[model samples]
Target: MSARTSAPSWRPANSSGRSLWLAIAGLSPPAIGDSHTGLRLMGDVLSLARRRPFTSAVILLIVAVYVVEIAQSRPAFWLEGKGDLPDIAALGVVWTPAIGDGEWWRLITASSLHAGLLHIALNCYALVVIGGAAEARFRWWRTAVIFLVAAVGGNIAAAAIQPGAASLGASGGVMGLAGAVVVGAVWSGEGLARSQWVIGAIIATVAFGFINPGISNAAHIGGLIAGGAVSLPLGLTARLRRTQRPAPAPKTQARGTAPGRATATGMNPRQVEFQRRIDAAMAKARAEREEDARRASSGE
Candidate 1:
């Protein structure tokens, strides 16, 4: 059974602009007449980290990769003039020309590559909150698969639209994580009210597309679809597991009898008596027929 969900104490009563900002930052405004705010806020953040190990690890990887990318992307680098990040160019940037030449691995590899500090930070923040919630709800492996599938889908979408343009980042995958949560909720019959947060997250993702110029909306959309595709099956599987019944054991038949025939073993008294009567009748009929045949031969 699913764990019971309740309204979070930290959730604001209304969706004002300030409230939205707080929600994005994963923080709550100071309550009326509350003094232990710092302690409570720290506790919430720590609790989140503890609950989502996979999310934390993914964030760390993104940060580490970004650090390496900045260090390597200098003026001396060969691809430095071509693009901002040399690490992205060397490691894996979704350059359509390269992909056309069979460097298809960029579809997956570009997910870890970022343009700048701002780019990585934004993506990491989304993953930490949205992806962490998803990981907490489902298993670690499912979350990982969803991220990868979304990443590939996003890159493919970008390449299809902008063949010559280069793109890199985890935004596509992050958007996908949000999309999966929303779709999974609907598939599981969690209802609209229960899925409001996920729905809001999708809206926020799309909102970012309009606000940010460099953001790949196509990749975001593709990742969203990919995430939903991967998570839908999990929902169906969970439903089947919940409703599936144990199969009945096979019945044993009597020796020399056809399948579905009454078995010799475990026969009730009435069935045993009936079988005995039928056998006796058959024997008497055979004896009478044999006697009649012998008499007819002798008389002739």
Candidate 2:
């Protein structure tokens, strides 16, 4: 479920190229793409579903939650949309279980819940795209951890800095994925270049101005940090990932026999091969993350 991944890793930021503003501002938010509109988000998912039945299920998850929220609004199932957008951070904090006042499960629930239909679709699309690329070189477990931390940190940060308002979206985690992938691209010499990275980061930072306030910059920044911090111990040296040959794609098997679906959505064999590859990659990255966490926990 988590598209957050590893095979996509990072290289250290240029410290000497420091910009105090970068520190103060964080990597800017990606253009909430021109295509990104609330209604568009809702429509795009539905449109994609026509060609791919599986994507229907993805939409179902979002609809199911919205249904729950509406039902809760009816004064029955639960108060608020499982949790309010305004209260997401508070819920994650004071209401989160065991730790503060919040339910322990919110850490997980928050990922599933999103700001709105717009939020849900955007993140889902991101998962399919970036995740497709990442899993090719990483591991699932790593994806899960990255998703969890990025989503949780993003929500927490948003709540802390922009408290008293409900907000939900996989964007925080997706943004983390964005940061991780951008770093990965730079390190691996893949999709983008280092100069492009800096430029993209700058544009994103500047676009923050037009983000129309109330968006969670905190969560965005926090997720970026989490991606970077977590990447450090994954053996992601400057040249290691850059010079490496790409990992092979995961091979598929009989329809039901494939360990994982070749294509969760309506996809060609090539697409399936691509997904299998990325999933395999994500799984590998997760293994590394586990080892890294283990090492840190053991003070190794």
Candidate 3:
């Protein structure tokens, strides 16, 4: 009957006592009539869904991606194999840059083009699920970065790895989104550790391989690598791309101040120090969060 005697002395002392006990032990008080932890946890989704702006747009993106792909499937285009570049040329079966140039823009453009209606449909389905979830875990720009980079990476790999091939499909990029979800879940702070997602991705990959005759594994792998890499520092790096700025000068060159040179009218040292601290703190937090996850995974 006593806590000292029982190995598992966790039994509740009836409903009334249990309620009182929880109230006393609660760190954050619960909502009235809502006693379940699952309810509270499900009640908040911003960190998962409702909080992300890019999520809603992603729906449109999904739709648009499929639409364009569907259109490309028609016989009007001159690209071989209905614009399925990888299938046509990855292994040197056929080759040309007819669909989209082997250019950087093609990375994104290919996402909008596909082999057929079914191909587009499958990709959109994957994107909606993966992109929706990715948007939930990562910031909007971060999601955008993974989408862009992964998509580009997939196309690039398709071009490089698949020799003499013209490939078109949202598969590479969308798969990248899936890769982001899987990897981000792996490297997250607290959420997105569902084993189901990983298992599901594996199943989907296998299914895609069996169904789509020319599915380029190269692109899928590349996009995944790109997504994981782009998850860090995507924001500022993106700014440089948009502005087309030349390389960022070293600290000494940016202010036009030589290594040891400064005029009476100089930059604010205090402000600079504060900015440095802010940057350092942010870096530290991100590193700590990642480290905690690493340790937890390693059984440390």
Candidate 4:
């Protein structure tokens, strides 16, 4: 009887091949593809972390603090604006009365705390944009100093202007970064068009604050002023130093001489010409003296 012939099976022939097939079918353990995807995501995060270490750390800290705030209070506190006042105060909101009682640390700490999800979200976004720019321009340490100084300045202004109200968020610091960028651009002679755009953005931001209720215009103003003040001398000194840099000495070449080439006599062209003139003068003087000596001998 003739043997019955069957078509070749599409199944993999080896265990490894079978495992790969099963993984593709979603029936096997976590596949290489999944691991690769995870690795790629981790690499991206690491790249971002390395690009701006201080900025990344600050953002992480803010988010972590917000998470702690959420854990300490009910969800309503972060989701809605109706959180308990005592709970908020405990979380380090800037209360003027508390400052009078010597909670002075709040001047800087309050900048890290937020009132709600929206508050933190807005502030964090601002930090990422403005703070990143400031960090790039002034470097991490200067950026840190600017942020802290602005935060303190803003809180102080708030305490002085609205002593009864409680305030929180990083708006002051963000505004300070914006201010520093503006001043830096101007000092670096970045041109009128760029400077105008930066100035316009600041004006628009301040205007928005004015139109919005419960926003601290005083803090914004104070931060802007403080940032500009801090950056002003730095900018001036940088400009002054740049201007004072000695001009490069002029390149000098020997007269009538081709660059990098010496005369046939192994002297520079200028030296050769000077020697020729000296020899000619000496020969003429010697000839005149000999003629005078001959004339004297004949007269004798």
CA lDDT of each prediction against the hidden true structure? 0.66, 0.48, 0.52, 0.67
- Order of all candidates by TM-score, from best down to worst? 4, 1, 3, 2
Badly placed stretches (over 4 Å) of model 3 are 1-103, 189-195, 210-212, 232-300
Q: What TM-score does candidate 1 reach?
A: 0.63
Q: Any idea what lDDT model 3 has?
A: 0.52
What is the C-alpha lDDT profile of model 4 across 1-300, one tens digit per residue? 101112121110000011112222233223566758787757755875787676777778889988888888667767754455665567776677888999998888777777667677666656655777778777787788888888789878877876656767777777777799888987787754654544665676677666654567677788888887787776676567769999987456445445533434467656767866776788899999999999999995
How much lDDT does candidate 4 score?
0.67
Worst 10 residues of 3 by lDDT: 9-18
lDDT of the structure predicted as candidate 2: 0.48
lDDT of 2 by residue, 146-225 (tens): 65677678666655654443345555665555566666666555657433543464346435623534344666677767
Which structure is stronger by TM-score: 1 or 3? 1
- The parts of candidate 1 lying over 4 Å away from their true place are 1-49, 75-87, 242-300
Candidate 4 wrong stretches, greater than 4 Å: 1-46, 195-197, 236-300
Q: Pairs clashing in candidate 3?
A: 85-166, 85-167, 85-168, 86-167, 89-165
Scored by lDDT, model 1 comes in at: 0.66
Q: Worst ten-residue run, lDDT, model 4?
A: 9-18
Candidate 2 or 1, higher lDDT: 1
Using TM-score as the measure, the top candidate is: 4
